[model samples]
Target: MPVTDVTTDHEALTMTLTAEFAASVDRLWKAFTDPAQLERFWGPPGWPATFPRFDFAVGGRADYYMTSPRGEKAGGSWEFLEIDEPRAFAVLDSFVDAGGAPADGLPTMRVVFAFEPTAAGSKLINTTYFTSAEALEQVVAMGAVEGSTMAFNQLDRVLAGLREYSAGKGTQTEILDDTHVRITRLVEGPRHLVWRAHQEPELMRQWLLGPDGWRMSVCEIDPAVGGRYRYEWEPLEGMPGEKFGFDGETLLWEAPRRAVTTEHMTGTDFPSTLNDLTLDEEDGATLITLVIEYPDKETRDMVLATGMTDGMEASYGRLEGVLERVG
Candidate 1:
């Protein structure tokens, strides 16, 4: 985790966060000032941030929103108040309405981002000043601390770059808390091609097969929110394993970027899991991130213990070949 400490001073009506990153101060500053880099890890795990408007200079403004897994959106804005290159900057952060106006009665805060060089890399001291104790308490009640920590933890991956971080990782799995697990892989293709490999049924059938002896016997996909998809796999002749399938309803779908769905074992009594799939492209390669939300710790463990990561690695390896042939 990048966040080392979080201190909430009720008396001073302030919240301070201290984090260290294995990146230089210049790189850290660029990550904050650059809109593309900021959006990559600004929000918590499932909720992703997008900056529609970003003016980086002092006296400018930035408008952004975080979209939830189910496609709900919460908007926020930042008014740049001060700027010192590669060192510090401050902004007035406020909740905003859909029309980009400040939301009525919501508390605004002053946030200062201070960066400094450390022996290993760099450190960030982030302080948010609230107008009153009520404002500070309100955010805490809203899970700001937990959310911020999760958001900051993602920064390390962004700083590392997709290819540098996950090229040879081969379907990395991270148990994020009890109910959530994150799976990641880097595809050696552009974002659009990677999206198509998942979206198109023909392409999916070509590469979605988990292992060598199995084939995708059925692939019925509807690429829209609230649509349903069913996929089944069957073993080749003389193979040992039995046939299995999964069915799911799409909860959210954003072409070439994100898709969220509920997945359940077909014809079984197993509980469903929410899969939030997102793709980020950098330097002609796409990073595939899938965060699965299980109903409980037991479900999470049960699903992961089945060699899921290994299967995914095989499937993704096939996907790279599919992309190469189709590109």
Candidate 2:
């Protein structure tokens, strides 16, 4: 169920989720075909999808839009294909700008949802395709794995609610794949300067956000292939946070170019997630692409639910501040 076993190259971030459900394939088919059921769980929670008009057919389409908190709008259309009743349905999807204009950032995802009739009920599965590996990574960063996982998980919960009325219990679990989630600051400085600041444990403790009395104990790196590394964060008295450390071996380390580290986590059933750092020098500055690959789609979704992206933006902001002050 590892969702993040992906390439650090933004072009290689594509992955898929597959799970079985104790419901009939036909029952699951309606969940997707029926607009009433879809509107309930479509488009990750909080930002609801408004299905203004839809016509489900071979050449039919689903037009929808989302309204952001700041009142900005995003709209898109879903084109259906090979719509076999109660068994298989395929659709091509894309993100459109406000007022239904096609945008360049998103790849046209080809999604195939299949329903398998089982002895108990139906097993639902979906496979999504990307135009390019980089296209997949772009969406992943934009929260593709998280968003799709959230949408399906929500749908599962919704179906479970309906199953209760049918005198049955729902049984489904969304498992996530190996993942890592952390902020890599992209600053307006040379890669060497930025790397030195980040590799410095003392500088990290000075600017990193923590409740109170929170400090970084170690910031060690080998910075070469076959190198092992570890870092620890300890919360002092009244810090209001748990202390943790990443004690994983580095799988790839090509100095100032790319580094991949395996992360270990306890206190949860799940264990390790993989993380990668790709440092690309752009215009004398480095575009540090930091990626966390989860062990499963479920864990990845959980990380997304925590709004880690916003936290990342915040963390990177701190990294910038530290760089400015130190410079």
RMSD of each: 1.1, 16.9
User: In TM-score terms, which candidate is top?
Assistant: 1
- Highest lDDT against the true fold, candidate: 1
Any residue pairs clashing in model 1, and if so which? none
Q: What is the lDDT of candidate 2?
A: 0.62
- Write one digit per residue (lDDT tens) for candidate 1, span 1-327: 899999999998999999999999999999999999998999999999999899988899999999998889999999999999989999999999999998997899999999999998999999999999999999999889999999999999888888787756789999989999999999899999999999999999999998789999999998788899999999999999999999999998888899999999999999999999999999999999999999999999998999999999999999999999999
* Candidate 1 accuracy as TM-score: 0.98
Lowest lDDT block of 10, candidate 1: 161-170
Residues 1-327, candidate 2, lDDT per residue (tens digit)? 212222223343335565566666766888788875676557653344668878999988898875432234677788997788988888888888766766776678787777777776666667677778777767777886676665565565446543242222111122323443433334555677666665566676665543335676766766554566677777776657777766666675445555566667534446676665544343455545455667677778776787555545555657767877877
Q: Please give the range of 10 consecutive residues that has the lowest summed lDDT in model 2.
A: 165-174
